[model samples]
Structure formats: C-alpha cells, structure tokens
Target: MIWIDTLAQGILLGGLYALFAAGLSLVFGIMRLVNLAHGDFIVMAAYLILLLVTLMGLSPFVAAIIAAPVMFGIGWGLQKHLLNRTLGNDILPPLLVTFGLSIALQNALLEGFSADSQRLPTGAISTASIDLGVLTVGVLPLLTFGSAIAVIVGLNQLFYRTELGRAFRATSDDATTASLMGIRPGNIFAIATAIAMLVVTLAALYLGMRSNFDPNIGPARLIYAFQAVIIGGLGSLWGTLAGGIIIGLAQTVGAAVNPEWQILAGHVAFLIVLLVRPRGLFPRAVD
Candidate 1:
C-alpha cells in the first residue's frame, strides 16, 4: 500500500518534470536548436509572475496569465533579433550564444532578485488534498498532472491539426526550402519560440507553486530537463513525459529504500535506459 502511494506520488511528480521538458522538446523538435538558456527563461517567468502578484495583487493564476504574453514577446524578439542569427550548419554558435544568454540571465536575475529563494503564494490550495481510499493526494499535484496532460494534448493538436503546424513541419525539415516556398523560416522559428515561452510560463507557475526557486537553480533544472529530453528521445513530446515518469518513479522508489540514493538513482536509471536503448524508449520516426 505504501509502495503504491509512493509510485502514485512519483507519477504526480513526473508531471512537473514533463512541464519542465515540454518547451525544450518543442524548440528542439522544430529548430534542432538547443537553448541552454531554456531553464533560465522559466525562472525568469516565475519571477515575472511573482512580480505581477506582488505589484498588482493578482492571484498566481491571474499573474501567470498576464506573464504569458510578456514572455511570448520576449521569446519572439529573442529569436527574431538574436537566436535566428545563430542557426545553420554550425551547431556550435547556437550553443555558445544560448550558453552566454544563460549566464547573462542568471547574473541579471541574481542582481534583481538577490540570492534568496522565492515561491508563489498559493493560499489554502497549496495544502489542499483529496482522499482516494487507498491514499491521499495533494490537489496541487493532481492539478499539475492534469495540466501536463492538457499541455501535451494541446501541443499535439497544434502540431498535427493546424496550418501553422504544417508550416512548422515544413520549416523544420528544411529552412531554405521552406523559405523558397515563402514560409519565412525565421518568422516560424520566432513563432515556435514564442509558443515555447507560453509553455514555459505554464511550467514556471507550477514550479513556483511546488517549490522554492532561486536564479542559481536554473542550471540544475536545465540538467533535469535535458535528461528528460534525452531519455525520451530528442524531439519526441510524448516520450518526454514517459522519461519524466521514469525518473520520478526511480527517485521516489530510491528514496523509499534509502534517501541518499534518490537523485543518484534517477541518473542511474537514465544511464540504464541509454545502455539498453541508445535511441530512447520512443525515437521519433525519420522521414
């Protein structure tokens, strides 16, 4: 019974990780450009939400709603004016640029927010829980898990059912050819990033509600996001969620056995997955 509860908790925890990795997965899938600054952007969004809550006296949910468009603009301008220049045959430039961007964002956040950790004020909802006969689960975790599912489903629909999605697929396949067809790959990239930023805003909301975070924590979050992305198979959204669940389950089960092994166990599971299936549990099919 206890083990069942732990597994359930772990699955819920994976929802948070899936949120972390979704935006990263989207950008990689579309542009093959890894934004090392991705996690910092999420932290930045959290701070933005915190700012709105503090200044406007809005609820966290309302603050996140306000932050979403602002973050989208930031992402759009970033890709349009800067990151797009870093694209092409040379992958090193995007990496170096985003790496620099990551460092700059961290320093900027540190200067603005100081070294203190911060969290969203969730009121009673934070402590709310529900009983399921077998075990009790926090309402916040349940909401987080539901949000993760919604996000993935929405993204899948956007990818498979929309005209913009077709553009995304075309541009992803070949930027030059896409441009030749008047698709404007640069603009598409910017839009893709903007959409990713929206997802980041959603991720940041849950992250702030769930745990305290500081600027320095972004890199650690980045590692987890990267691990989830890799373990899932680069560019595969559904697989990313699976990877997060695997890590979550491993960590929780490890902690159950011995608290000291929690984090290490996740890494070990990732390594085991890589050893068994270097391409990941579900690799995106090549066209």
Candidate 2:
C-alpha cells in the first residue's frame, strides 16, 4: 500500500516534469537547436508570475494567463533578433549562443528579482488534499497532472489539426524545401519559440507552487526536463509524459528506501533508459 501511494505520487509528480519537458521537446522537435537556456526561460516565467501576483494580489493562475502572452512575445522577439542568426548546418552555433543566453538570463534575473528564494502564494488549494480510498493526494498535484494532460492534448490537436502545425512539421523536415513551398522557416521558428514560452509559463505556475525557487535553479529543472524528453523519446509528447513518470517513480521509491537517494534515482533512470534505448522509447520517424 505504501508502494501504491509512492507510485501514485510519482506518476503525479511525473506530470509536473512532463510539463517542464513539453516546451523543450516542442522547440527541439521543430528545430534541432537545443536551447541551453530553456530552463532559465522557465524561471523567468515564474518570476513574471511572481511579479504579477505580488503586485496585484492576483491568483497564480491569473498571473500565468497574463505572463504566458508576455513570454510568448519575448520568445518571438528573442528568436527573431538573436537565435535565427545562429541557425545553420552546424549545430555548434546554436548551442554556444544558447549557452551564452542562459548565463545572461541567470544574471539578468538575479539582478531583477534578487537571489532570495520565492514561492507562489496559494490561499487554500496548495495545502488541500482529497481522499481517494487508498490514499490522499494533494489538490495542487491533481490540478498539475490535469494541466499536463491538457497541454499534451491541446498540442496534439494543434499538431494534427491546425495549418500552423503542418507548416511546423514541414519546416522541421526540410527548411529549404519548406521555404520553396512558401513556409518561412525562420518565421516558423519564431512562432515555435513563442509557443514554447507558453508552455514555459504553464510549467512556471506549477514550479513556483511546488517548491521554493531562486534564479539559480533553472539549470536543475532543465536537467529533469531534458531527461524526461530523452527517456520518453524525442518528438513524442506522450512518450515524454511516460518518461517523466518513470523518473518520478524512481526518485520517489528511492527516497522511500533511503532519503539521500532521491536525486540519484532519477539520474539512474535516465541512464538506464539511455543504455537500453539509445533512440529513446518513441523517437519521431517523421522528422
């Protein structure tokens, strides 16, 4: 029964990780460029929410709604002015650029928000729990898990049902070819970044609520997001969720046995997946 509770909690925690990963995976799938700053962007979004909530006494959810569009604009402008220039046949340029961007973001946030740790204010919901026969679960966790599923479902719909998604996939396959066909590769990337920032905003809402966050913590979140994306397989949203769940389970169960083993356990799961499936559990064939 304890195992059951742990597993359940892990799966729910997986949902949060999946939220962290989804934006990263989306951008990577569309453009082979890995944003080393992905995690920092997440932290930035959290700070955005913090600013909004503290200034206006708004709910985190309301703050997220406002921050997402702002983040989208920032992502769009960042890609348009900076990252677009870094794209080429060689992957090194984008990596270097994003690495620099990550450092810049860290310093910027530290200057703006200070190094003090912060947490989202949740009036009643954060501490509330629901009994489900076998075990009690946090309401915030359930909401987070629901949001993760909603994000994936919404993304799937956009990818499969929208014209923009078609353009996105086409550009991913062959940018020059896409350009010849009237889809602007650079523009698509900008839009992709904007969308990725939307996901970051959602992830930020949960991250700040779940634990204390400081400007320096983005890289750690990036690691977990990256592990989830890789373990589940690249370009597959559902697989990303599965990967997060695997990691969550490993970490929680490890902690159950020995408190110090939690972090190590997630990394072990990632390594195991790498060893067993080099291409990931569900790598995309289309791209």
Candidate 3:
C-alpha cells in the first residue's frame, strides 16, 4: 500500500514536470531554436501572475488568464525582433543570445523580488486532496496532471488540424521553401513561440501554486525540462509526458527507499534511459 501510494504521488508529480517541458518541446519542435531562457521565462510568468494577484486582489487563475496574453505578446516580440535574427545554420548565436537573456532575466527578477522564495496563495486548493480506494491524491496534483494532458492535446490539435499548423510544419521542414510558398517562416516562428509562451503561462500558474520558486530556480527547472524532452524524444509531445513520469517515478521511489537519493535517482534514470536508447524512448523522425 505504501509503495502504491508512492507511485501514485510520483505520477501526479510528473504532471507538473510535463507542464514544465511542454513549451520547451513545442519551441524546439518547430524552430529547433533552443531558448536557454525558457525556464526563466516560466519564472517570469509566475512573477507576472503574482503581481496581478497582489495588486488587484485577483484570484491566481484570473491572474494567469490575464498573464497569458501578455506573455504571448512578449514571446512574439522577442522572436520577431530578437531571437529570429540569431537563427541560422550556426546555433551558437542563439545559444549565446538566450544565455544572456537568461542571465538578464535572473538579475532583473532578483532586483525586483529580492532573493526570497515565493509561492502563490492557492487557499484551500493547496491542501485539497481526493481519496481513492487504494491511495489518496492531492487535488492540486490531479489538476496539474489534467492540465498537462489538456495542453498536449490542444497543441496536437493545433498542429494536426489547423491551417496554421500546416504552415508550421512546412516552415519547420524548410524555411526557404516555406517562404517561397508565401508562408513567412519568421512570422510563423514568432507565432509558434507566442503559443509556447501561453503554455509557459499555464505551467507558471501550477508551478507557483505547487512549490516555492525563486529566480535562481529556473536553471534547475530547465535541466528537468531538458532531461524530460531528451528522455521522451525531441519533437514528440506525448513522449515528453512519458519522460516526466519516468523521472517522477524514479524520484518518488528513491525517496521512499531513502530521501537522500531522490534527486540523484531522477538523474540516474535519465542516464539509464540514454544508455538503453540514445535517441530517447520515442525518437521522432526529423526529415
């Protein structure tokens, strides 16, 4: 029973991890432009939500809803005016640029919020839990898991069912060719990033609600997100979720055995996955 409960908790925790990686996965899938500032952007969104909640006495959900469009605009402008220029055969430029962006965001956040950790006040929801026959689960965790699924499903639908998705696919395959067809790859990339920022906003909401977060925590979150992305397979959304679950399970099981092993356990699992399958459990054919 203890083990079952542990596993269930771990699975729920994976939902949060999945949310962390979804936006990173989307941006990479579309543009292959690795945003080093991705996790920092998530943190930034959290702060934005916190601001709205503090200033207007709005609920966290409402604050997140308002933050979404603001984040989208920021992403769009960042890509359009800045990140797009850094894209090319040489990935070094974007890497450098985003790295700087990450540093700048961290410094800015530190200056504004100080070094203290913060969490959104979720009230009763933070303590709410559901009883299953075999095990109990937190309502917040369940909601996080559900949101992860919904985000992935929504992204899949947008990618497979919409005209814009077609443009995205075409542009990703070949920017020059896409441009010839009257599809502006640059603009499409910006829009994809904007969409990704919306996902980031969702992720940020859950992140703030679930745990203590600070500006410096972004890099750690990025590592988890990146590991999940790699473990699942690049450009594969469903696989990202699976990867998060794997890490979550490993961490939970490890902690059950010995608390000291929790974080190490996740890294070990990621290593094991890489050893067994270098390209990940579900490598998408990128051609």
Candidate 4:
C-alpha cells in the first residue's frame, strides 16, 4: 500500500518536473542553446502572475493565459536580437551569453522585486485535495502534472505535424543546410524560443502557486530540469517524463526513509542513469 501510494505521488510530482524541463528541453533540442536564465525566466513569469493576480484580481489560470503570449514575444525577440548573434559552430559562445543573461536576470529581479519570496495567490484551489481509494492528491499538483502531459503531447503533435515543426527539426539537423533550403535558422530559433517561453509561463503558474519562490531559486529548478532531460535522453518528451518520474520516485522513496534523502536520492538516480546509459534512456541515433 505504501509503495503504491509513493509511486502514484512520485508520478504526479514528475509531471511538475517535466513541466519545468519541457521548455528547457525544447530550446536545447532545437537550437542546442542552453538558456542558463531558464530558471530565472520561470521566476520572472511568477512575478508577472503575481502582478496580474494582485492588481487585476484575476484567477491564476487567466493570468497565465495573459502572460504566456507576452512571454512568447519576449523570448522570440530576445533570441532574434541577442541569442542568435551568440550562436556559432562552437557552443561556448551561446553558453557564455546565456550565463551572462542569467546574472543579469537575477540582478534585475532583485532590483525590481527585492529578495522577498513570493507565491501566486490561487485561493482555495491551492489548498484543495482529492482523495483516491488508496491515497490522496493535491489539486494544484495534479493540475501541474496534467498540464505537463498536455504540453508534451502538444509539442509532439507540433513536432510531427506542422510545417514549422518540420523546419525546426531540419534546423536542428543542420542549420547551414536549413538556411540554404530557405529555412531561416535564426527565425526558427526565435520561434522555438518563443514557444519555449510559453511553456515557461505555464511552468511558472504551478511553480509560484505550489511553493514560495524568490529569484535565487531558478538555478535549482534548472538543475533538476537538466537532470530530467539528460536522464530521459534529449529530444524525447516521453523520455523526459520517464526521467522525471525516476527522479521523483527516488526522492519520495528516499524521504520515506530519511527526511534529507529526498534530493540526494534524486541525484543518485540521475547518476545511476548516467552510469548505465550515458546517452540517456532515450536518445536520437545521430543527434
């Protein structure tokens, strides 16, 4: 009974981690640019949510709806104007640029919102829970997990179905060749990033409502997201979800034994996965 409950809860928790990593994975898989500021962007979106809720008295869902498109534009413009310039044959330039962006974001958030931790006000929905036959689940967590699946499925559809997605894969395959084919690699990257930011906005809603977050917290989330993507193997949404579940299950089972083992367990699982499958549980053949 205990194990069953643990597995169920961990699976749900993985959904949240998947949400955190989806945007990161999307950008990385498509452009190979690791947005070091991803966590901070999540934090930024949270602040946007906070403002909307507090000032406009809107529900968190509505706030997310409003913020996602705006975040998308920010992401698109940022990539077009800034990150595209940093990209090259060598990955180091983009890494350095994103790292600097991370620092800048943290400082900017600090200046604007101070160091105080904040949470989105979600009313009673934040506190609500559902009782299953064997266990219980929080509504917010369930919703986060559901959203993660929806995002993954949606991304899969987009990747396999749309012309833009075809361009994205082609761009990911060979930017030079893609450009020669009249696929503007820079524009593709910008659009990919914009979509990623939309995912980030969704992640932010759950993140802020589920826990109190400050600007300093994004890096940690970024770490978890990185692990999940690596463990799942890059470029596979289902793999990412599996990776998150593995980490989540490890953490929860560890916590059942010792309070502090939660995070340590997840890391241990990540290390084990790396040891056994260096390329990840699921990876592209050539990529």
Candidate 5:
C-alpha cells in the first residue's frame, strides 16, 4: 500500500513535469528551434500571473486567463523579430541566442522580484485530498495531472487536425519548399511560438501553485524539462509525458528508500534511459 501510494504520487508529479516540457517540445517539433530560455519563460509567466493576482485580486485561474494572451503576444513578437533571424542550418545561433536570453531573463527577474520564493494561493484546495480505499490523492495533484493530459490531447489534435497544424508540419518538413508554396514560414513560426507561450502560461499556473518558486530556479526547471523531452523523444508530446512519469517514479521510489536520493534518482533514471535508447523511447521519425 505504501509503495502504491508513492507510485501514484509520482505519476501525479510527472504531470507537472510534462506541463513544463510540452511547450518546449511543441516549438522544437515545428521550428526545430531549441529555446534554451524555455524554463525562464515559464517563470516569467508565473510572475505575470502573480502580478495580475496581486494587483487585481483575481484568482490564479483568472489571472492565467489574462496572462496567456499577453504571453502569446510576447512569444509572437519574440519569434518574429528576434528568434526568426537565428534559425538556419546552423543550430549554434539559436542556442547562443536563447542562452543569452536566459541569462538576461534571470537577471531581470532577480532585479524585479529579488531572491524571495513565491507561490500562488490555492485556499482549501492546497490541502484538500481524496481518500481511496488503498490510497489518497491531493486534489491539486489530480488537477495538475488532468491538465497535462488535456494539454497533450489538445496539442495532438491541433497538430493533426487544424489548418495551422498543416502549415506547421509543412514548414517543419522543408521551410524553403513551404515558402515556395506561398506559406509564410516566418508567420508560421511566430504562431507556433505564440501557441507555445500560451502553453507556458498553463504550465506556470500549475508550477506556481504546486511549489515555491524563485528567480534563480529557472535553470533547474529547465533541466527537468530537458530530461523529460529527451527521455520521451524530442518532438513527441506523449513521449514527453512518459519521460516525466519515469523521472517522477524514480524520484518517489528513491525517496522511499532514502530521502536524500530523490533528485539524484531522477537524474539516474534519465541517464539510464539515455544509455538504453540514445534517441529516446519514442523519438520522432525525423529525429
């Protein structure tokens, strides 16, 4: 029963990790642009939500509703004006650019918010849990996991069923040819990033609610996201979820044995997965 509970909690925890990686996976799938600042962007959205809540007394959910569109615009403009120029046959440019952006964002956040940790208020939901015969589960964790699944399902539908998704796939397959077909690769890239940032806003909502966050923590979050993405296979949303579960399960099981091993266990799992399948468990065909 103890182990069952631990596994259940880990799976729930994986939902948050999946949220963290989903946007990163989406942008990479469409544009092949690795936004090194992805985690910082998540933090930025959290701050946005906090600001809205603090100023307007809005609930976290409502604040997120306001923040998502704002973030989408930021993403659209950033991709159109800055990141688009960095895309090419050479991958180093995007990496260097996003790395610089990451540094800039961290310093900016530190200057604004300081090093103090912050969390979104959830009232009773923070402590609320459901009792199962064999195990109990927190309402917050269940909500987070549900959100992750919804996001994945929504994204899959968007990628496969929508006209914009068709544009995304075409651009991804061959940008020059996509351009020749009268599709604006630049516009598609911008929209893709905007969509990614919208997802970031969703991720931020869960992240800020789930745990205390500080300006300096973005890089560590990025590490988890990167691991999840790599573990699931780059550009695969469902794979990303599985990777998150793997890490989450490893950490929970490790902590069961020895609390000190929790973080190390997740890293070890990632390394083991890499060793076994260098391309990841469900790598995209192009990858």
Candidate 6:
C-alpha cells in the first residue's frame, strides 16, 4: 500500500517536472537551439508572479495570466535581438550565450529577491487531498498533472493543425528554404520562443505553489528538465512526459528503499536509459 502510494505520488510529481521540460522541448523541436537559461526563465516567471501577488494582491492563477504576455514579450525580444544572432550551423554560440544569460539572470534575481526561499500561497488547495480507493492524492498535484497534459495536447494541436505550425515545421526543416517560401525564420523563431515562455509561466505557477524556491535553484531545475528531455528523447513532447514519470518513479522507489538515494536514483535511471537507448525512449521520426 505504501509503495502504491509512493508510485502514485511520484507520477503526480512528474507532472510538474514535465511542465518544466515542455517549453524546453518546444524550443528545441522548432529551433534546435538549446536555451541553457530555460530554468532561470522559469524562476524569473515565479518571481514575476510573486511580485504581482505581493503588490496587486492577486491570486497566483491571476498573476500567471498577467505574467504570460509579459513573458511572451520578453521571450520574443530576446530571440529577435539576442538569441537570433547566435543561431547557425554551430551550436556552441547559443549554448555559450544562454549559459552566460543563465548566470546573469541568477545574479540579477539574487540581487533583486535575495537568497531567501519563497513559495506562493495556495490557501485551501495547498493541503487539499482526495481519497482514491487505494490511496489519497493531493489536489494540487492532480491539477498540475492535468495542466501538463492539456499543455501537451494544446501544443500538439498547434504544431499539427495550425498554419503557424506549418510555418514552424517548414522553418525547422530548412531555414533557407523557409525564407525562400517567404517565411521569415527570425519571426518564426521569435514566435516559438514567445510560446515557450508562455509555457514557462505555467511551469512557474505550479513550481512556486508546490515548494519553496530561490534563484540558486534554477540550475538544479534545469538539470531535471534536461534529464527529462534527454531521457524522453529530444524534441518529443509526449516522450518528455514519460521521461518525467520514469524519473519520478525511480526517485520515489529509491527513497522508499533508502531516502538518501532519491536524487541519485533519478540520475542512475537516466544513465541506464542513455546506455541502453542512446536515442532515448522515443526519438522523433523527423529529428
């Protein structure tokens, strides 16, 4: 029964991790540019939510809605002005630039918000739970899981069904050819980043509500997101969710056996997967 509960809880927790990875996956799928600052952007969004909640006295959900557009603009501008210049045949430039951006963001956040950990207040929902026949599950975790699924489904539809998505596929396949087709790769990239930042805002909402967070924690979250992305296979959204669940289950089961091995267990599982399947559990056919 205890093991069952742990497994359930772990799967729920993976939803949050999946949220963290979704934006990363989207950007990679579209642009093939890895934003090393991806997690810091999530932390930045959390702080933005905190700011709105503290000053405007709005709920976290309301704050997220307000922050989404602001984040979108920031992402668009960043891609248009900064990251766009870094894109090319060589991947190192973007990696180096985003890595520097990550450090700068961490320092900027630390200067502004300090190192103290903070969490968003959830009122009743923070502690709310429901009993399933086998076990009890937290309402917040269930909501997070549901939101992750919705985001994935929405993104899939957008990628597959929309004209913009067609543009994305075209740009991703060959930027020069996309340009010949009158699709501005720059604009497409900007839109992709903006959409990614919107997803980041959703990730921030759950992260801030779920646990205490400080600026320094972004890199750690980045590690988890990176592992999830790699374990699931790069550029595959559904696979990312599966990867998160695998890591979550590994951590929970490891902790059940020995609490100290929780984090290590996740890393071990990732390594095992990488060793067995270098391309990941589900590599995209196109990628």
Estimate the TM-score for candidate 5: 0.98
lDDT of 4 at 142: 91
Better of 3 and 4 by TM-score: 3
Clashes of each: 0, 0, 0, 0, 0, 0
Per-residue CA lDDT of candidate 3, range 1-287, in tens?
99899999899888888898998998898889889999999999999999999999999999999999999999999999999999998989999999999999999999999999999999999999999888888999999999999999999999999999999989988889999999999899999999999999999999999999999998878888888999999889999999999988999999999999998999999999999999999999462
Model 1, TM vs. native: 0.97
What RMSD value applies to candidate 6? 1.0
Q: Per-residue alpha-carbon lDDT of model 1 for 1-287, expressed as tens digits? A: 99899999999988888898999999999999889999999999999999999999999999999999999999999999999999988989999999999999999999999989999999999999999999999999999989988999999999999999999999988888998988999899999999999999999999999999999888877777777888898778889999888888898999999999998988999999999988888889452
For lDDT, candidate 1 versus 3, the one ahead is 3
Best by lDDT: 6
What is the TM-score of each predicted model, taking all chains together? Answer: 0.97, 0.97, 0.98, 0.96, 0.98, 0.98
* Candidate 2 Cα errors over 4 Å, as ranges: none
The alpha-carbon lDDT assigned to residue 224 of candidate 2 equals: 94
Error of 3 at 201 (Å): 0.6
**Candidate 6 — worst ten consecutive residues by lDDT sum?**
278-287
Model 4 scores a TM of 0.96
Where model 5 places Cα greater than 4 Å from the true spot, the runs are none
After best superposition, candidate 6 residue 220: deviation in angstroms?
1.0
lDDT (Cα, 0-100) at 44 in candidate 1: 95
Model 4: lDDT of residue 170: 97
Clashing pairs in 1: none
Local distance difference test values of all predictions, in order: 0.92, 0.93, 0.93, 0.90, 0.93, 0.94
